[model samples]
Target: MSNKKMSGFTIVELLVVLSVIALLLSIITPRYFGKIKEGQEVVLKQNLATIRHAIDQYYSDQGMYPTNLNSLKEKRYLRDIPEDPIMKNQEWQIIKAPNEVGVYDVKSRSNEISSNNNMYSEW
Candidate 1:
């Protein structure tokens, strides 16, 4: 018989390699999705904080809350109203000012639950 060994992987060896790759993917994919969702949540929180800060600044400067989100951009309090990451929209749940003439607090219009078991709006 010839002394040379096989030059490439056998069918069984190839199957083992494929199974290992699949196992690794199965383990990694869920964590990857979890990280993406976590990142979106973080972005949502930062956007909310920025918008709230802009609202406060507008209130302090104008002596009233903004009449609308657009007023903040028009008056340069914010370059733009930060879009809600979770809802994938710029539509914010505007809380009216106590004076009944302007925006107060804001909330997410999304109904999704957060990691803390609260609805995104409640956050």
Candidate 2:
């Protein structure tokens, strides 16, 4: 019989490698998701600020708030309505001015708790 050397990983070696990979994944996955959420939160904050700033500029220019986000876009106060980073949509919770008939402020539609331990809507 001719002698032939095996050129493959053994079952034990494969198991060890797989187990190590799984262990590393277990340790890393939660943190990865947390970081993703954190990134989304930062984006959410910036989007909110941008929309609010646009609303303020519109109000300042017109002496009243725009009737809706579309109005801002119509007059070029905003190029577009920003997507809510957390909700992944353009919907927002609009607050009317105390005595005015248009958007006075905007908040995230998401009620999800943020990393800072505050509701996203409250951001």
Quick one: how many clashes does candidate 2 have? 0
lDDT of each: 0.91, 0.90
| Candidate 2 local lDDT, 10-96, one digit each (tens) | 999999999999999999999999899989988998999999999999988899988888888899988889999888899999988
Could you tell me the TM-score of candidate 2? 0.92
Q: TM-score for every candidate vs. truth?
A: 0.92, 0.92
Tens digits of per-residue lDDT for model 1, 1-123: 799876987899999999999999999999999898899899999998998999999888888888899999999999988989898999999889774799898999999998888999987
Model 2 global lDDT (CA atoms, 0 to 1): 0.90
Model 1: lDDT of residue 84: 95
Clash count list over all predictions: 0, 0
The lDDT of model 1 is 0.91
